[model samples]
Target: MLIKECKGFELEKEKSNTSEDFFNRSEVTFIENGEEKTLHVLYVRYFDEILQEFTPYSQDPILADQGLDVTFKDIVALVCLLKNPGLRGRKRLYINSKHDFAAYFQDIDFSKLPEVFQSLKQKNSYELRSPLEFILQPK
Candidate 1:
C-alpha cells in the first residue's frame, strides 16, 4: 500500500521512549483486515557498550570518537533480518520484506529509491542503516 494512503494513526506513549529518551516513536494504524499494527520509525541511541556487543570491528572514526551510537532505523533493519530466518547474507543492510518496510517507514516512498541503493543485495555485518533506499526513500 502507498504511504500516502495510510492515515489517521496515533502514537502510543508507553513505547515511545527508549533508554536515552530518544523517543522511539511509531504510528499505530488499523489495517484493512482490522488488525492494529505499529510503524515505529525513529532513531535509537546506542552507547559504547552496546556498540561493542554488535560491532567490535567498527573502525569508523565517528563511532570511536563519539562512543558509538546507532539510530532506530539501524535497529529496524537488523530486526528485519533476524525476524526472517530464511534470508542469507554476511550480516549487512538490504531490503528483505515489503510488509515490514511499509510498516516501519510509512513516510518514505520506495519507488524513487536510487538504482544503486536498491540494487544493494549485500547486508552490512554491523548495526547501521541499510542502503539509502532502506532508510530514506529519496525525497
Candidate 2:
C-alpha cells in the first residue's frame, strides 16, 4: 500500500548527501496486517527536513512491499552471532511483515513462546539466548 494510505511514518530528506537527486530519505517504518506500527525501534536515518516531493525517499516504495529489510547495523550483529554469540547485545527480530509472521508459525513450536505477537514492554522468561535466538515478536 502507498505510504499515504498508512497511518504512521513521515517523509524526510537526507542532508548528508549533497547531491540534489539523492538527498531524499525516510526513517523506515513497517506495516502489519494493513496497519503501521513499531516497538523500541531506534532507526536513525530520518531526515530533519521534509522533502516536499521525495516520497519517503530513503527506500524506494518497493521496500514497503518486501517489508523492512535487515539494516546494516543489524546485519553486523547477525553475522557476529554466528562467529561469537557472547558479545552481541540482546537481539530480537521484531516481525514487521506478513511473511515473517507466517514463517514463524511454520518453524517454531507453539509452547515455547505462545503469543502470536508479543510487545517488548511485557516482561517474559524467554530472554535467554540459545546460541542465537530469533523471535517473531511484534510492535
Candidate 3:
C-alpha cells in the first residue's frame, strides 16, 4: 500500500563542508493502491544512504530548545497533520492562524527529537534534508 509519490523536488547545494549543502536537488515518487503522485523533497545523507529526506525546519531554535528532535519522519507527520486537520483530534499541534509554519517548532522539544540526529556529523546530514520534503511526503 503506497501512500504518496514525490514526482519532483529542488535541491540547493552549498559549497561549505556543512551538511546544509548536501541535498541540492531531488525528487520522489509516491504510490498507493495503484494511485501515484509526485512531490518535491530535499535529499540528504541518512544512515548509510544519501537518498533520505524530511521536512519542517530543524534549524529553528524553537525545535532545538523544545528538545524535540526533528527528522524526515517528523516532517512527514507534521505535513500529515497540516493536510488533515481532522487528525489533530485532541492534540494541540496545529495553530489556528500562522503564515510561518516553522514557528510551531518553537513549542517542540529539540532534545526529544528522534535519535537519528543525535550526532554532530549526522547533524550535518540533517541539513541536507529539507522541511518542504516532509510536507509533500505522505504520513
User: Using TM-score as the measure, what is the rank order of every candidate, best first?
Assistant: 3, 1, 2
Error of 2 at 1 (Å): 37
Error of 3 at 125 (Å): 22
Compute each candidate's TM-score over C-alphas: 0.23, 0.21, 0.24
* Over 4 Å off, model 2: 1-11, 16-119, 124-126, 133-139
Q: Which stretches of candidate 3 lie over 4 Å from their true place?
A: 4-10, 13-28, 41-82, 85-139
Candidate 2, pairs of clashing residues: 25-58
Worst 10-residue stretch by lDDT in candidate 1? 1-10
Model 2, span 1-139: residue lDDT tens: 1111111232244475544332222222233346543222222222213211222234322122223332222221222232243322333333334343233233222232222112111332113235223332444
State which candidate, 1 or 2, has the greater TM-score: 1
lDDT of the candidates, in the order given? 0.30, 0.27, 0.32
Give me candidate 3's TM-score against the actual structure: 0.24
The residue-by-residue lDDT of candidate 3 on 1-139, one tens digit each, is 2223212222344555555544322223333345543333333323113112123343422134235433343343334333443433332232223233333333333332343234322443222133333232344
Q: How much is the lDDT of residue 104 in candidate 3? A: 32
Task: Please write out the lDDT profile of model 1 over residues 1-139, one tens digit for every residue.
Answer: 1111111112245554533353233221212233333343333333222333333234322122222333323334323332332222233333334444434344333333322122221221122233333444343
